[model samples]
Target chain A: MNLKELYQEIILEHGKNPRNLRKTEDFNKDAKGNNPLCGDNVHVYLKLNGQKIVEDISFEGSGCAISMASASIMTDLIKGKNEHEAKEIVEDFLGMIKENPELMSENLDEDEKTKLMSLSGVKQYPMRVKCATLSWHTLISAFDENKEEVKTEN
Target chain B: MNINQIKKEFPIFDEKIQNNDLVYLDSANSSQKPKVVVDRINEFYTKQFSNVGRSVHYLAVAATNLYENTRTSVQKYINAKDKNEIVFTKGATEALNLVANTLGQSYLQEGDEVLITELEHHSNYVPWHFLRKSKNIKINFAEINEEGEITLEEIEKKITPKTRLISITHLSNVTGAILPVKEITQLAHSKGIIVVVDGCQGAPHLKLDMQELDCDFYAISCHKMYGPTGLGVLYGKKKWLEELPPYQGGGGMINEVKKDRISYGELPNKYEAGTMATAQVIAFDQSIKFLESIGIENVMKHEADLVEYGQELLQKNNSVKLIGNPKNKGGVLSFVIEGVHPHDIATILDEDGVAIRAGHHCCQILHDKLNIPASARASVGIYNTKEDLDQLNESINNCKKIFNL
Candidate 1:
């Protein structure tokens, strides 16, 4: 309900020019996700090295400002982390968005947590929480190598 | 009665929607119910509850008479020749499916073509698609013009000698372009092609006269007419209803059942197989009376004015692009902002209790043709006022300011 909190200046900037919004050239893991109700879709691509460190991560999709910003911030934070750390960060972010007061991931710095917490406004609008979380769930699907596309519910 | 006074009839306006007075602009999705219609449902269930079309008890026969009385009311409302021509279904979706399934069973043959417009809702398109997969039937789509209208010319261009049926919406839900159903039905009948209308949008606002239109079949959504949910009316010609097979087989639709052979019942009971939505059907008579009280012509005029005012308001706003410019439009006003996504706009608007719809509106074919993922829509009803459109315009400005447009 709070428009200023939901459409923060950083979120709008990220939505306007989302980071790494392209197909990874040598992606090893990938998965698709969609919000069938709103026609928003995303494809997460990851390039993992031999030691399972995140080498490169990118995505391709079209959606509203909240979704695009969520995906952009996610891809920015997820790069260079190992598989275990990446999954933990995903869980912490999802937990914070759902009910927890703050990000609990040991891997994320204070600045990174603040950037993700900017999306906490979505908690008030239950219908829009899915828009912010769809791309994060799709990233997990990519890491797990799940073949089925990820679909979000309210 | 004054059209503006109609808002007082619906009690929802008196309550605050999230601390904001309800400025309902989503009536095209489903209209707000009048008190009479709502009270009728409660009265029926409270004191006069009984299963209709069965049993010899007093309440049963009384309920049966009440149910049949609604059928007669609908027949007179739509100007149909016979009362049995109007059959009750679960919804407009089921009505369209019944037509497609029954035609697929007896009338349609393999390799035959069914013509539909790009403006059809999923309910109209998906039923015919089932026939395509199972019977090798061909489904053809008539393209819309730049104004987002499926003109008579466009429909004519798509018709073929093998086209057995033409199913289309009486009004485009997204574009609000009212199709020339009567003229199109005339053309289709001349070529021996059946015409089935998806009147979900049309039934609420338009003047429905099945006899004058002469279409093979028409489907109506009662919820959109300020009636209760779980009820719809299908107006098929008596001849077609007699010829087509039953859609769902159950207790009521059978005349005689045996181990080896079973015979179907008469026209309406043949289609209404199981226990129907009796209370909703009975309450729907109040909805018809509601419309009759205001008169369709007055409703049409009021809505037309509202749309015109809404169109003008949005057109003057910068960065707001109205979707269609059809000369013959109804209550729908679909648009997109250059920078703001429709979902974002809708969220911002909802904060002010200005209810509108955002997405494909179940006409993905039209949206795909328009080459956009989705657009926002604001549709008017009898209770909507010019001030509602003004509030909508002010909200759009707020959304643009938030998006830094």
Candidate 2:
């Protein structure tokens, strides 16, 4: 109920001075994603060194605090992970937000659970879940293009 | 006039949201249904549910009578010349598109012009845009004055010898400014240009007579006028309807189909293709009756009173900026607080059980012209009361406090 707690200093700082906010111009794979409902758009670029993501960078164009912060944190999390590990991270993030099945098991580590719990506020607002995950899904599609794999249902 | 008595007719007023009474103020987008309309649909399914005008069975005959009676009701509702001029469409969007596609294609030449205003909704804008692209016709726009009212001078300036048609909104959904349709139609007619009026907002608030207004075509949506969704009325003059070709080709709209050619049906049926929205059409009759029983003059007076009350209340705060200043406006009032974004203001209002619309309102071009990202709109209807306006004023004041503006 407290908006001060909802929009904490960490979220504001990440939103204001986002990390990895640059275009990968020479990157092999890139894709543009947009949430048509809210008009949030993000262009994700992936520099993959033979399936291991060497440099994962993104630049976002959005209107809200939560969406920009989510994009910042997602780009920071998957900067150096390989494609397989990045896919698992996306699945974990999707589970935390959309209540997907993988994270329902009670086997998460303390730090991983804490990191996922940062997005727990999104569960209360269904309309905002897409805003929080737009950048992450775009990154998934970028990696899919790099690996020459067709995307499944979003 | 009694809030409690009127509240009893709408079931949503009794429903609780977040353990609080629901205050719906999005009637400009779509009005909530009264019990009469809801029960009309219920009765049709329970007793007389059947497709109309086809079967010889008893239910079909009864359904045909009910459906044809609705046509008569609508003909009288808008004071059209004949029932044949009324064609049931999906909604005003489709109705406007029906006119634009058929008439715009048949009459408009490569160098001709279609004159519209900047205040048109996308439904009125995009169809003409498509026509311009396909037919190589030029689209001209009349400018709005500082008061958000379109002037006769502007319309005259925009019209030329090549201008073939003039389509405009009867009332602006954003600023609630009522355009002078009768004068504009007369001017357009004198210039030998046909006129089409988007009556989605006006039909719900004002009294309309197609003959008196003398507009060649008028598009109306049922949902905005307390009827069901998926049904709208397009009132065109019989001469124009007879001249224009069929909009869509399908089963009911045609009389016969041969190897290469086909014969079309009668006046209204020629334009209405496929199986119509029967149940919603029947329920639309009840919505018409509901409005008729209250009388449109009373509805207009009550809404005008709310508009004046809202203007007096909200404009007291220095932070609130009212959008338009027409001498004759509708019940809609769009405004923006000084520092807070419209979306944030809407969010805070929603937490306090106050509903409003906050966006470009499908008028992106108008927003671009006004150079504002968006504005918050509070529109009124017959079901609304002074208490609703008070809630809106209080909630907007709370938004100012929250933003420390």
Residue runs of model 2 more than 4 Å from their true location after superposition: A1-31, A42-60, A72-89, A100-118, A139-154, B317-320, B337-341, B397-405
- DockQ for every prediction shown: 0.82, 0.18
The per-residue C-alpha lDDT of model 2 at residue A31 equals: 70
lDDT score, candidate 2, position B19: 63
TM-score of chain A of each: 0.98, 0.79
Best by lDDT: 1
Q: State the C-alpha RMSD over the true interface residues for candidate 2, after superposing those residues.
A: 3.5
Clashes of each: 0, 0
Candidate 1 collision pairs: none
Q: Can you write out model 1's per-residue Cα lDDT over B219-258, one digit (the tens) per residue?
A: 9999999999999999999999999999999989999999
CAPRI band for model 2: incorrect
Q: lDDT score, residue B191, model 1?
A: 96
* TM-score per candidate, chains pooled: 0.99, 0.87
lDDT of 2 by residue, B1-405 (tens): 564676689888888766666667788899989999999999999989999878999999999889889999999999999999999999999999999999765888888899999899989999999988888889999988898888878999999989999999999998888999999999998879999999999999999898899999999999998899999999999999999999999878888899998999998889888889999999999989988988899889999998999999988878899998888899898997766656556666776677788778888778778877678888887889888889888888876665555
